[model samples]
Target: MSLLEAVAMLAYYDPDSECTVMREVPFSDSAHILLRFLHSRNFQTFMDGVPQITDFRYTNEAMLGIVFDDNFAPLGMIQNSMGFLEGGTVVRKSFPQSDLLMSIPLLSDLVGSMLGKGPYFIANDAGPSPFELGKGPLYRWANFDEVGTQDDPLFQDAGGTTTYTTTENEVSDIRDVARVIFKGPLNLTEWYFSTRLVADIVAALFPFGRDYGINFLHGDKLESMPKIEFIAEQGVLSGGTFMFLPIPGERELIKGYNHMDVLTACASLPSPGSARLRRAPHWNQLATTIAIPPLLVPAPAETQTSGVADIMETIEDTLMPSLVLIISYDDGNRVSNSQTGFFCTPQGHILTALGGIRNSPMVNVKTIDRGVFKVKRVMGEERAFNLVKLTADVPASQMKPVSYNRSIPVYGTQVYAVTIPGPDEKTVTALQVTGTREIPGIGMVILTTPSIPAYYNNCPVADARGQVLGLAVSESSGGAAVDFIIPSAVILGLFVGATPVSFEDWEAREMLQGLDNTYAEAMRLLWLGRFTAAAPLFERAAKARPQDADPLYYAAACYENTKQAARAQTLYEQALKADPESVKVLFSLGLLHARAGRAKKATALFAEVVDREPRHAQGHAELVKLYAGVRNRDLMQKHLALLRGLDPDLAEDTLYEIESAGRTRR
Candidate 1:
C-alpha cells in the first residue's frame, strides 16, 4: 500500500471575487443572466482556478459544466462553454452539441444566426431540424447525433442528465424581460453541494444559506469549519471555496499506505496509525501507562539541565527566603507551636493557614532572620484557600513581603516547600504538585503533591521564581503522605471588594455604553456581509474604545473589502500594535500576505498563529495548503498531524476533496 504524502487541491473559488457586470434581474430573467455571466473569465477562474482556461488539462470547454438550483435541488446546466470578458461583458458563446437541443428549435440560439455554423459546437450555431426528411437536411442533435440524413450513422449520448440550456447571444431586449428582483452585495452564511451532475459537474447552485445569525466575533476554530459561506451581490454569484484534506491512503486512490509516514512517527501512539491501521487513543484521549516507563519532561536541547533534583534545587534557592514562620497564641499566651506565614500585602499584611490561626485572638510572626513581630488584627479569612489574612504591627520597612504570581502553574512546574527547621536555618526541597483534587463538602482546592513532614503545613509553597503561593495544609490523617497547598490568588481574593461608583461617573459610563452599542451593531453588519456599511461603524467603535484591537482589526478588514487598500493597511498595523498576541489579527494579516503571493510573510504569520495557539485548526489548515503549494511534503504532513490532533472530522473531509477532484495527481 502506498499513501500520498502531499497536498491535493481541486478547485479553490474565491467567494469575494466579482463576476457579474450586470445585476438586478427578475426571477424570469435571472437564470438567463446567470448563465450569461457563467461564460466570464472570473467564473472560469472559480470553476478552474485560472481565468481564460482556453483548454482544460483534463477536458475542453464542452466538458467544463455547471448546474444551478434555487437554494434546494438541481435546476439546470450550461455545459462545455467559454466566455469572452470584453467591453464590460462576457460574450464568448457556449454551444452545447447535446441531444436535448434538437427537440426545441427556438429555445436554442437564434436559428438565423446558425446560418453557416459548424457541427462540433453545442449547437449554438444550429438547433432542431428546420427541414424535414425529403425536403432538406435532417439536422437534429438530440438522443441521436449528427446533422445528416438517413445515411448518417447515429451516436448515443446520455439524455437523462441535461436540463436547461442557453446561448450567450447578446439579447438587447433582456432588460425589458427582467427587473432587479434582489439587489445585493449581501452575505449569506449557508452550506450546500450540488446533488446531481451532468458530467461530474455541480448541478446545483446556492442550495442553502444560513440567514446572518452570526456566531463568531471571536476567532473560534471549531465553529468556522464545515459550513458553507455565500457572499453574493446582485448579479455576480459567489460562494466560498471548499477544499477536502485527504490523509495518506484513506481513499481508493492508486496509492495508499501502512502507517502515515509523518516525520513524527510517535503521533501514531495517540491517533490511529494512518498507514499502520493500528488502534490507539485519539490525541485528545488521555493515556494511562502505569507499569510502563515514565516519560521524562522535555527541556530545551541547548540547555544542559539534566535531573529533576538539580532543576528543582535551582527553583528552591529562589523561593525559600520569602516564606516566614508563624506561632499562634490564645489570649496573649503561647497556644500553637511554630506555624507558617508569608507577606500578603505591601502594608504589612501576613497570610497564614486558617488551621494555624485556630481562631486565636493573637499570633506571633517571625522571619527566617529570627526577627519577631506582633499581629495587629485578623483582617479576613477563606475556607477554599485555607488561609487567614492578618495585619502585622510592624511597618512595611521591616518586612520582605512576597507577591502573588497570577499565572497558574501548569501541571509539572517544580514547586518547593519553604520551611525553617530552626532559627536562622531556612530550607527548601523539591516537591511536585502532581495534580489536584476537590476537597468534597469543604469546597477547597486541594493540590496533590509529594509528601513532606507535618511541619511543612502552614508553610508557603513557592515556584522556581520564589513567588509565594498560599498556605500548604499538612495532612491531619496519617497514611500515605500527600501535600495540598492553596494558591495565593485564591487566598488574596479573600480581601477583595467591589467599589461603589458615584453618579458623577455617568458621562464615562455613557461613553462606554455607546462604544459597546456601536461595537455590537458594527459586528452585526460585518457578519451580514455589509462591509461598506460596517466599516464606518467599526471605526466609530474603535475611536470609542481605543485600547481594543477588535474594532480596529474589523474596520481594517471592512476597508479592505471596500477596496480602500491604504486605509486598511494603516488600521491593520495599528491593530497589530494594539494587541500583538491576537491570532485572529495575525491570521488576517497572513491572509493578506497569502493573497499577495508573499509566501514567506504568509508562512511566517501562519506559523506564529499556530505557535501561539496549538489548536488553531484554521492556522494549521492554512499551513497545510502553503506547504502543499511549496511542495514540502514533510511540512505538510507535520501540519496534517496537528490538524488531525485538533479535529479529525475536518481531516476526513479534506481527504475526500483530495480524492474527489479531477486533475488530481498523487
Candidate 2:
C-alpha cells in the first residue's frame, strides 16, 4: 500500500466503532494519486434495526491527506472532502499542487491535530471497561493465533473477553504523515472550530468566513418516529456583558458565552408536519441607546477703565529725560541717518536700534537738557535683535532710567508710543494693543494698532501706568504700527556689566548682513506717507539687490504717490524688465498704462495676470472696469462671472460700475 493510503486507514479506524477501508486508484492528472474510502453501511443498518438503540445515526466523514517525496517534502495533497461526478462514478478531488497552500502553517497545524494512532495488537481483560454501555457484545472481525498473547483492551467486547492478531504495519507508518478528518456531514465552506481553536483560526479568516457555527445532528429518520429535537451548547472563557433575545413563535431560551468576540446564529423554524430544515435570514432585531446634554452659553466681560492724562504726565516726568536723538555721519561730515534712543543706566548707557549706526564712523547722542555728545565706548550689541548699547559723557542729571513693566500686555490694552525728534521735543501717540508674538532669538514682542509715524522706530511704548513695555523694533503690518517690539525684559539684559569695547572695534564687526532689513525700513516709510524720505531708501535697496524687482517696484510706487509719474513710469519699466513674471509689477504697470490712456496695452497685461493666477480677485476686478469703459458687455459679463466666485464683494462693486456706465451711455 502507498504511504497516504496507510495513513488514511489509520486515521479513519475506531476500536469501539465501525471501521472504514481505503482503496488506492490510478489518476491521470497533476495529482500524485487518488484514493476512495468505502464506509461500511451494514453497521448503520444494524443500529437502525435494533429497537433499543435510540437516536442513533451514521456520521459521514471526509478526509484530506498530504503526500511527500523521497526527501519528506510535500509533493501534492489528496482529499475526498469534496467529490465530483466524472463519467458514471463520483471521483474524489485533490487540492491542486500549489506553493501558496503548502506554505501556510495553519493548514499544516490543522492536519496534524486530527492524526490518530493505534497499537500493534489488542488485549482482553476480565474486568468491565469504563466505556461499556452494557447494550450487548460489541465485535470486530479479526483472525487471531490460538497461542498468541493480547497486549491491549482497545477491541475488547463489553464482557471484556476478546482477542485479535496484530495488523499494525499499516498504522505505524503514519508517524510522519499529516491528515484531518471531518467526522459529521461535510460542508464545502463551513468547518466547525472548537472554542479553543476559534481565537486563532477564525480570526485569520474573518468577514469572508463569517458564517461559521457548530453543527448539531439529532437522530436518524424512521417511518413512525416522533419529531427530532436537539440542543447545541457553546461556552466562552471570559466575562463581559451579553444579551439574549427570544425567537419568533417559540419558547424563549437564550444564553450568552464569555470571551465570544464573534457570534453567528443560524436557526430553523418549521410548521407542523414538516420534515426538512429550511434556511432563514440573519438576526438583526437588536437595539441600543445613548444620551447627551445641552450646551451652555458664556456672558460678555466688562471693560476696564484707566486715567490717560495721568499716564501721560507720569511718562513725561520720568522717561522724557532719558529719550535722546541718535545721529550718524559719514567720513565727509554729512548726516547719514537719524533715529531715537533712551538711557538704560545712570552711567550714560544709551540703547537704540543698530540699523542707523551700522556703517557710520561718527555716532553722536543729543540729550534733552544736555548738548550733543560723541559716543565714547560700545557697551554691548545683539545684531539679530537690532539693538546696540553705547556710553557717552552726558550730565548726571539727564541719565534718568525709565521704569519697565515686566508683566505682558494683552489685546485691546491702551498704550502710548513716545518719540524724540530733536532735543527737548517729543511726540507721544496713543495706540491700542492689538496682539503679541514670541519670536525665536528675539523672545516675546508686543504688537499694537498703528497711529505712530515711520520715525517712531526705536521709540519706547508704555502702558497706561507709564511703565515701558518694549522698544518699537520694526515696520507696521496689518493693524499694528510696529511689526514687533523687543520687550523690556530683553532690554534689561544689556545692563549686566560686560567689558566695554572701542567705537572702532564695534564698527569692525560685521555690518548690515542682509538687504531685507533695508527693504523693510523703506516699506515702513512708504506706508507712513513719507514719500520723499522713503524713495531714497528704496533706491538704495534697489542698487544693493539689482536682481530683486520688489525694491524697484516700491520705489516706483513712492514716486507715483508724489505725482512724479514720469519717474515712476521709468522705474516701473525697469522693474518689469528685471522680473517679467512678477504679478505685483504686472498689475501696477497695467494700472499706469490705463491711467495714461493706453487701453489696449493695459487690457492685455490684466489678461495675462488672470491667466497666470486664475483666482486673483483684483485682476478680475480691474478687467471688469476696463471692459465696461469700452462698452464690451459680453466680455465684461464673462469676466464678472469668474470674479463673483473669487471675491463676491469686488464683483458687486464691478456690477455697480457696469450699471453706471450703462446709465451714462443712455
Candidate 3:
C-alpha cells in the first residue's frame, strides 16, 4: 500500500478550541515571514559550522515554490462559507484572504523594527476587504471535512489523516502563534532543520521571548505512522514527527527506493527480502526490509565515529586529566562534601562553583595522578555567578589545565560535560546548547540541556574540540531549574591581579555582609548547606525587613541546621506570628516541637499545614510517620494514601517502615 510521504506543512494552533489546523502553505504568516527575511538578504551568516542561509537554496522564488504549494487559493474558495461553532447554532465565517493581508503588514513592521530596515517590502500587498463577511481565521474555530471513518481509503495509508477542510483567517496579532515549516533533508539523514533556525524565526515574530514552544522532528523514514503530534504552548523544546507513503508501481519507489530505504536503514536487523515489513521496538523500526544476499567481509575493525562520539572522545582523553575532585569540610562538624573542579591555570589554580566551598573551613583537591592536596588559597570569586578560583599546593607538572574557547557557542551548538566521578575515571555527557546569557562583568554563560546531574556541578563543560566552554552550574530560569555554565572568560575576569588569601581569611571576608547583601543570596547559602554563613545574613535581612516572614523562617532553619534548637524554636515562633498563613513555617515549627517530645503539638501543627496546603507532600509524610509511631492504623493508612498520591516512591518506603514498626511493637 502507498503510504503518505514527501509532504511539507505550515500550521497554526488555536489554543481556545485546542485545534491545530494547517495554514495556507506558503502564504501562512510564518512562511511569509521566513521567505521575506530570506529574500531581504539581511541574514547571511549564522553561527560557525552551521550552513549559511544561502546554502539551503531557497533564495529564489522558483526554488521556494518547489517545496511550498500555494494552498491559499483553495482555502479562499470556502472563506465565505458558514460553519457551526462548538455547541452553538451561530454560523461563523472565515475570511482567510483578508486576515492574511492584514497580518503581513503588521509582521513586516515587526521585522523591519528588529532588523533596522526602514519599511521593508510588503511580500503580499492584498489589502483587507472593506466589507466584513465573517471572523478572521485566527479567531474562529476549525472545521474538518467529512472524509468518512478511519477505515476510509483516504486514510488507508496515512495520506489524508492531517487534511484540514477549512482554513482560519490569519490575524495581525501573532503573539500566541509559533512559527513552523518543514525543510527537506539536507543530504540523507540530517536536515537543514535545527532549533537555531526555529529560534531565529521565533525571534523575528516575537522580539522578546525565550520560553516559547518549539518542536523538532528528525527521522530517517516513516510509513503509516500511527501517532499524534502535539504543539506545546509553553514547552521550550519538543520532538517532531515524520510520515512516509510508498506509492505502488512508482519508479522512484522501485529503483531508488528512497522512502523504503530510509525505513530499512532504521531497522535493527538486516532486511530479509525486497520490502519486507516487520515489527520492531522504535518508531523508525516499523518497516519492511529490502532483503538481498550479502557477500560479507570480515567485520570492520572500527565504526566511523559520529560527531558526538568524537566530541566525547576529546573530553575523555584531553579534558578529564584537568578535572579534580573538590572536597570541602565544614568548620565545627567537619562535614565534608565533594564536587567537581578543574585546573584553570598553569600555576595550579583551580576553578569551581562557589556554592561547593562557600562555608568550608578547609578544602582539598584530588587529582588523578597527583593524589590529594590541600587548597592553599582562594584566588578569586564571582559570588553572583557562584564561581570561585583556588590555588592548590599541587605541582605545575600535574596540572593539565584546559584552555578557554574565547568565542562563545551560539544556541543549538553541541557541548560536552566532563565529570570526574572518581579519581581514576570520568563520565562524559553530551549536552545541546539551548541558549545563552551575558552577565555584566561575568561575560557569557551557556545554557544547555535541562536538569543537569547534581554531581556534574562545578565540572568543566567543553566544546567538541576539547576547549573549555565554562564551569557547569545549575541556575533557575523561566521558573524551571536548568544547568548552565560560567564561561572561562568569566572565570578569568575574576582575577584582577589581587593576591590570594588563605581559606580562613576569605571566610572572614564573608563577615562584612552589608545592606547591599540580599535575602536571596542568604537563601542560596542556606541551600548550599552553609548554615553558619547564612544565619547572620538571614538575621540581617529579618532586621531590615521586619514584616517579611521568609527571612525569620529561613533564619530559624539556619539555626536548626547549626544545632541551636532553642534559638530555632524562638525564630520559628516569631515567623509563625508574622505570617500565620505560612505553611512551611508551621511545618518546621511542628517538627521542632515533635523533636522536643511534644507529639500533640506536632500533630496539631501538621494538621494545620495539610489544611493550608492540601498538596503538601512532606506534611502528609510527617503525619504518617507520627501516626505509625503511635500505632494508629486508621490515621496512618489515611495519611499513607495521601502520601501515595503525592509521592508514590516515598509512600512505598514509608509503608515498609510502618509495617516494620508494627512488627516491632507486636
Candidate 4:
C-alpha cells in the first residue's frame, strides 16, 4: 500500500477499505464556477443555522503572520517579533479612512470604554457609509449605550471550564484581539501623566499602541497648550495644528493632528497584535477647524462644486479671517471713508495706502472679529508710492499675515481688485491688464489694468492665478480705463529687501510634492486676494509644475505684483523660453524691459509679436509706445496705423502710453 494510504489506515484504522474508487475528470472553467456556486450555497446554509450574534466586520486592517521560528528565519534579532523582506518607514503616509461601511450594529459598544480618554471611538462608529446609508455620520459620537443585564450569551462566553466574574473579562478575552484593552482616562489638564497606564499598555501590547483618549482646551497638555494659545491669541503660525503623541523610541505610536488626533492611532499591526479596532475618523468633515490646511481637501460627498465655490472657500480660509481692521480716515469735516486693512507682518504691522491714512497719527480701526484699537501709530511709509506701514495695539502674530512673492505680474494678466464699494460689501472684481508702462529707477513697468477705480484707489490688485500684482494708485495717467499699479517689485523693495530668484535655480532646489495641489490652490487664491498667503503656495506650485509655463507665469506675476521687478523679469524670460509663441508672455517680457529702461530688448520682443500677428492690438500699441519714447516717429506711426485699425478706441486712449514713453535718450 502507498505510504499515504498506510498512514490513513493507521490513524483511522482503515477508511472504508471496500469503498469503490471514484473516477475524477479534468477541471474546466465551468466546473470551477459550478464548484464555487455550490461552496457558497453550502456556506450560506451553514451560516443560516449558526444564529447571527454579530457582523464579523473590521474597521482596522492587520497583517497575516504566524509565531516566529528561528529554523525558518536564521538571520534575525532576538527582539524582532516579525520580519518581512523589507524594513522601511513611511512619513505621514496613511491618511484617515473614508466611507466606513454601514453596520448592522453589534458588539463594538464596549470599544469606547476600552480605549483611553478621547471620545472619537464613541463617535467613529459613525453609522454607515454614505453610499449605503445615503448619509454618513456627521458626528460619530452616539447619544446613548445599552444598560441592564440584557447582553448576548455569545459575548458572555468564557473558556477553560471557568465562568469569569462580572462577565466583562469573559467578553473582553474574545474582544481584546479586535479592540483596545482599557487603561483608564488620560487627562491632558495637568503636568503629570499616569505612567502606570503607559507601562500597563506596553507590557500588554509591546512595541505598539492602539489609541488613547486625549483632552483639548480645559485639559490641554501644559507643553502643547502654550503653543496653541500663542497661535489662537497671537496668530503667528498658520494652517492646521499638529501635536505628536508622547511616544518615545525610533517608532512613534502614531502622529496626532489637532484635537481629533486623540482618537485612534490607525497604525498597522501584525497578526495576534493587541489592538482596539475602531472605525477611522471622518477627517474630511473636520479639516478647516485646524490651524494648517491638509493636503487633500475632501471633495463633496454628493455633488461636485463648480470652480467658483472652491475659490470662494479658499479665499475665506486664507484671507477673509485676517482682514479685520475697519480702517477709516477723514478728509476734514465729518466726511469719513473706510477701507479694510490686512495684517502685513507676524508682529502686528499693518500696510495700507499712505494716502488712505492721510499721515494721520491717530485713526479708528476695528478688528474683523474683535473690538477696535485706537491711537494706532504710523510706523513708516514709502511716501513716493503712497504706501504706509502702521503699528496698532494688535500684533501681527495675532492674525494671519499676507505673504509676498518675489516675481512680478506680466502685462494684460487678469487680476482681482479687492476693494470696498458699498457700506456692507467687501468686493472682489475680476479685471484684466490693459497695458504696461516702463519707467527708470522703479525697476518694473507700471502695470495698468481696467480694474482700477476712484473708490478702489490704494486697494490691492491680484493676478488671476493668485498673487497680489500691485497696489492700485489714483493715477491712470490720462487713459480713462487705466488704473496704474505700483508694481510688486517696487513694493517689496520698498519694505522688504528684494532678491530675484532664477527659474532654473528655484526649480532645481525647491522640494516638490507627489501631486499638483499646491499649484491648483495658489492659482485659486489669486481671486481671493491673499498675495502674501499665496506666495509660498505659488512657490510650491511652481516647483510642482516645472514643465508647465502657467505656474511659473503666476509665480512671476506674484513678484511683479509685489514690486520685485527684476525677479519677475527673469521668471518671465524662463516662461517665454518654455513657450516661445506665447504672444501675451512675449508682450509682458517686452514690457518688463521697457520698465527697466532697456528699450532695445523691449523693442525686439514687441517687434517680434507685431511682425508675427499684425492684428494683435496690444503688440502694435506697445511698439508705437516704445517708438514714440525714442523719437522714432516713423516706426511709431507705422504701428500706430495697425493699433488704430485693430482697435480704434484703444488707439484713441493712448495718453498713458505718451505719459510713460520712458526717459529721454542721451
Candidate 5:
C-alpha cells in the first residue's frame, strides 16, 4: 500500500473523525487514475459498488497519486483548518459524525490542511470500539439516537445499549479523488486553489477590488477549451454567468480570465455559490463599456467683407462720444464774422487779425460746443504790425501744445499759398518763398489777387513747412503777374529788432524789397481811397491779427462800400458786440441799417449815440442824414441844429456842401 493509502485508512477507521487527502498530478494524466488512487487509499473506496482496500503498510507512497484530468494541470494548494493539501484530493468523511464522503477537489486542499494542522482533529474517547469503528454499528447507533430515547429504556440507561432496526441508506462509498492535472510541469506559483481565497486576499489588500466581486472558477469550462464547440451568447460572458480561478501573483496577465472559455467551463459546473463565483462575467464588460472617446470639435467660420464693415461701424459708434475738434478754419461765414481771420498756433495759441480788436480790445472766441469767450489781447498796436498772440486760460492738465519751429532759410523758393478772398470775389493769394533774392534779400515772395483791387496790405505768408517767407504788401497791373511779393530780408532790416539771415550763397540774394514795399504802399493808398477791390487785401491783413477790431471794422466798411449791405450789417453787428463802446462799430452799425432801408431804426440809433456823446459831430451828421431819408423834416433840422451847436463852422459847411453836391450831381 502507498503512504497515501495508509493515511486514508487510518482516517477511515475512526467514524467520529474527518479526513482529507493531498496529491500532485502531472500535465498528461486521466481522471480515472485519481479515482483508482483514492480507491486504494481508503477502506470505503468502491469500484462498481464493491468495497476495495490494500494493506495500509504495503501501499506505495512513491506513486504521488493520479492526476485529476487528462491534462494533469497543476492545482493550487488550499490551506484550511484541516491543514494544507493539494487540490483534487477527496474528503473521506465529514468531521465527528457521518460515514458518507464526497469528492471536492477545490475543498480538498483546505480540508486536508485543516486536518493536518492540530486544530481540526481530536482523539475520540470512545476509541476504536466496534460500535463506532465501522459503518453498520455506527449507523445502528445513530438510528437509535434518532428514535425516542424515553420509549427505549435501554438507550436511557447509562450502561445499557438498545438494538434498533434501521432503514438501508446509500453511503458515499465512492473514493473520488479531487486532484488537478496539467499538460505542463506544475509550477507552484502559477496555481490558484480557489477563486474565493484569491479574491478574499485581493479585497483585503486592496479595498477598491470589492466594487466588482471576485469569481473563482472561470475559463475552466469545456467551451473555453480550444477543442470545444459552443456559441457563447454576447451577454453570457458579461452577466453573472461564469466563475474563474485567479492566477496568483499574475493578476494583470489574467485580468479577463473570467472571459476565457476554459475558466468559464470550470465554474459552470454545479457547486455551492459564492460572491467570487458570481462576479466573473460582469467585471470585464463594465470596464469596456466605460471607456471614453477622443475629444474633437469643429473650427469657427471665417469673417467676410460685410462683417468687417460691421466691425468698423461698431468702432465708430464706440469712439463717437470721444471725438474732439480738429484744427480747421471755415472759409464760409459759418462762425462769427469777428472769428473770420483767427488762426491756431502750434503752441495752441489763437492768433486773430489785429484790426479785429482795435476798437473793443476784445475778441470773441468760439469753442467746439459753440460757446463763446471774450479774449483781451490786441496785436499790431502803434505803427509796426506784429503777430497777434491770444493766450487761452487752458489748464496744464487740459492743454496739448504743439512745438513751433523758428528757423529762416535763404534762397527764397516759392512753395505754397494760403489765401482769403476779397470783395471782387477773387482769391487774395500769398506766396511762400525761401533763400536770397537780389532785391528782397531772403525769405520773400510775390503776392497777387485778381479779385482784390490794385492795392496791398502788408501781410506775411507762411509756407506749407510753416515758415514765414514774405509780406504781401502790393500789386501792379504792369508787373509779371499783376502782383508782387516783398522779400523778408529787406523787411527784416527795416523792422526794429529782427533775426540775422544765413543763405546758401550770397550770389543768390534777391533785392525786390523796395519795389514790393512801393507797390504795398500803393495798395494801401487805394484801400484808404475806399476801393471796394481792396477788401481782399484788407482781409489778408485782418487774418494776420484777427483779434483787432480795426481789420474787421474796415473789412465790414469795404463790404458795405461794395454794396454787400446784408453781409455788412451782419459783420458790423458782430463788431459792435465785440466792442460795444467803439465809435467806429457804432457808426458802422448805423450806416449798415441806413443802407438796408431801415431809416427809422438807423435814425433812432444815431440819435441815441448823439445823446450819449453830445459833442459827437459824426453822430449828429448821421442822425441828420437818417432823419432826412425818413422825411422827418423836423427831426432832421433838430439834428442839424445839434451838430451846429457842437461844431458851428463844420455844421454850416456841411449844409452848404450837401446842397452844392446835390445840385452838381443833378
Candidate 6:
C-alpha cells in the first residue's frame, strides 16, 4: 500500500494515538541517505520534529448536554445534529448546551491564556476534530466504512438464536470518547495555526517593527506545521493560516480548514513550498538570515561618518533664521476710518494705516523684539485706506533689506500678510492676495477677494501664485473692486525721485482727500451732537468700532432724548464709567433723572458734578431744578438766589419766570 494508504488505515483504526506519520520529499537529493537512516533505526524512528497531530471527538452524552442546554427538544437536537453533519462539525451547534460548555468558567480562563480574549467557539460546537467520523468513498477506501452502516451483514441478527441491544447510555458514552479522541490532534493544529497566523498578522500590520527587526521563536524547527503562509512582495504584506481535512481522493469532502488565503494575499507573503522560498535572515538580530538586496549591506563606519557630516552642513547652510512682516489697522471712529496699513516695507520702513496715526503728533513703530522707534520724515500719505509711507535708513551694519524685484507688479503679484492682531495679543499668522481693482468713490485699492476674518482689514490683494499684490482698501463695505497697490514701478520711482503713475490720477486723489475731510467734519459734528440730534451718526460710528466706548455712550443719550428713559439710563451709566470727567455726559445724566421725577437721584448726581467741577453752572442750574421738583422751597430759593449773586445781570423777572415755571410743572 502507498504511504498515504497506510497512514489512513492507522488513522481509521486507532485515531486516538497521540501521533501519526506521513512521507515527505526532501529538497536536496538525499532520499537514499534519509532512507538508510530510517532503516538503521529499525523502521521505527521517532517523529520528533514532525508537526503535532489533532484529535476531535465528542461523546453522545456531551452532544446531548449541548443540545438540552440550548432548550432544544430531542427532535431539535436530531435536526441540529443532521445540520452539523451536512455543514461540517466546525459549524456551531444551534442548541444552548454548547454555549454553556463554552461558558464553563474555568474553561474560558484556560482557553483565554491560549487564544487571547477572543471567543473560543465560532458559533456553538467546539472546534472541528482532526479525526472525523465519516462513511463515504474516502472512509470506505480507508477500510472503516461499514462501522455503522444499516446494510452491514455483520451487525444484522434476524435469527432468534441471539439478541443484541444498544442502550442509550452506552451509545452516549461511546460517542463521547470518540469525540474526545478526535479532538486531540485538532487542538494541536489550532494552536500551531493560531500562533503562526498571529505572528504574520502582527508583522504585516507593523512593517516598522519588521524594519527595525523582531524576534519570533528561538527553536530550530517548529513541531507543528501551521496551515498558514506569509508572503511579502513589492513592499506589500499579507498572511493567514488554517487547517484542512479532506475526504481521501475525492478533494470535495473537505472540512475543518480555516482559510488564511485572504490574509496571505493581502500581506503579499509567500505560499508554502513555492520555488521563491529561501532561507530568510533572522529578524531583530545580527548574524540572522534576512531578506534584502544582495548589494545593500550595512554602511561602513567611514561612510556613516561622512553622511553625518553632510547632514550637519545642510542644517547650517539652509536653516538660517529670517524675519517676517505683519500688516494690520488701528481703531477708527467712522466706517471710512482708516485702520489698516502695511507694517513692514521692502526697504525696512514700517508703513502705517494713515487713519490710525492721523491725530497723533508722533507715530510709533514696534518691532518683534518689542523695540519702539518714533517714525520721522513721513514721505507720503494715502487717504483712501489711510496708508502712510515712510523710509528708514537700514544701515549696511544692520541686516540688509530684502531685494525689491521691480518686474513683479503689485497689481497681479501674490503677497502674504503677517500681523500681530492685538495690543497685548500673541503672534498671529494669516495670508491674503491683493486684488487687481482699485476702489470706486474712495481712493483706496479694493480686492475681489472675500473678507477674511483673520485679516484686521479688508482682503489684501494677491497674485494667483500668492505673491504680494497690495494692501486692500475700500469703504469697508460694498466698495468698488478697484485696488490700490504700491506698484513695483511706483516703489522704484520713490527711490529714484520720480513721480508715480498713481500721482497722475489727480481725480482719485482729490476725491479721496475730499472724502477724508468730509469724514473728519462729519465725525466732529456727530461727536458734538452725540447726546442730541446726531444719534444716527453715532449708530453708524458705533457699528464701525463696536468696542469704542464714546459712540455707545452717545447712543445711550440719543435713546434718552428719544424718550427711551430706561435705555438712556443704562447708557448714561456706561458712559459715566467710560469717561468720568465728561461734563456733557454728567449734565445730560443729571437732567435725565430730573425730567423723570427722580428728584433725589438727580440731586445726588448734580451734587457729584458740582464736586467734580465747582464752577459748573449747568450743575448748579440742574440742582435748582431738582429742588423745585421736590417742592423744597427754601433749597430752590437759595440756589436761585445764589445764581443771581454769581451773575448780577441775572434778571429778577427771569428768576421769577424760572420759579413760576418750576411751580407750574410740579
Better of 2 and 3 by TM-score: 3
Query: What do the candidate models score in CA lDDT, each in turn?
Result: 0.45, 0.51, 0.52, 0.42, 0.35, 0.36
Order of quality (lDDT): 3, 2, 1, 4, 6, 5
Best by TM-score: 3
Q: For each candidate, how many residue pairs have backbone atoms clashing (under 3 Å)?
A: 22, 1, 11, 42, 90, 70
lDDT of 2 at 357: 89
Q: How many angstroms is residue 552 displaced in model 2 relative to the true structure, after the best TM-score fit?
A: 28
- The runs of at least 3 residues in candidate 2 whose Cα sits more than 4 Å from the true structure, single-residue gaps closed, are 1-310, 422-426, 476-482, 494-499, 510-666
Against the correct fold, how does model 4 do in TM-score? Answer: 0.28
> lDDT per residue, candidate 6, 170-199, as tens digits?
111112222222233232123333566566
Model 3 RMSD vs true structure: 21.5
lDDT by residue for model 5 (1-666), tens: 133334433332332332223232222233444443333323333233222111111111111221111111122122110111121112222231122221454343343222221111111122244344222111101211122222332212233342211111101110111111111122111343446656565653443432332212232342433331222221122212122533232112222121122232222212122223234333344335544221111111131134323433443333222112212222352332342332333444444333333323123555433444444333212122323445444333333332222334322222222333335522223222322222200223343322223333333344444444444433333332333444444343332222222211111221211112322332343423434655565556555544545555665666776678776677677666655666656766776787677877777678777766677787888777666555688987988998888877566556644553443344
Per residue, candidate 3 scores C-alpha lDDT tens digits across 1-666 of 000011211222222431222121223455544433333322321113122122221112212221221121111111111111222111111221223333474553333222221111111211233233222222222221122222331211134344322211111111111111222222211323246665655553442322222222222222343333321111111111111223222221112111112222222212122122122222343223332211111112132125445657867898888888888887674747888888888777888877767667788898989589988888877554567888878977788978888667765566777887755444977666766764321235676664466567768888878898877875442244445677776666565544578877986665344324466576556545567887888888888767667788878888887799999999999988887887768998999988888888999999999998888787898899898778798998898899999887577556655654553344
Error of 1 at 201 (Å): 52
Question: Any runs in candidate 6 off by more than 4 Å, and if so which?
Answer: 1-549, 645-654, 662-666
Please give the range of 10 consecutive residues that has the lowest summed lDDT in model 4: 62-71
Candidate 1 to truth, TM? 0.32
lDDT string, candidate 2, 356-378, tens digits: 78778789998888579998888
> How well is each residue in 238-350 modelled by candidate 1, as lDDT tens digits?
11111133222221211111111111011221111122212222222223432212122222223323454454565556654555778866555866566667776776676
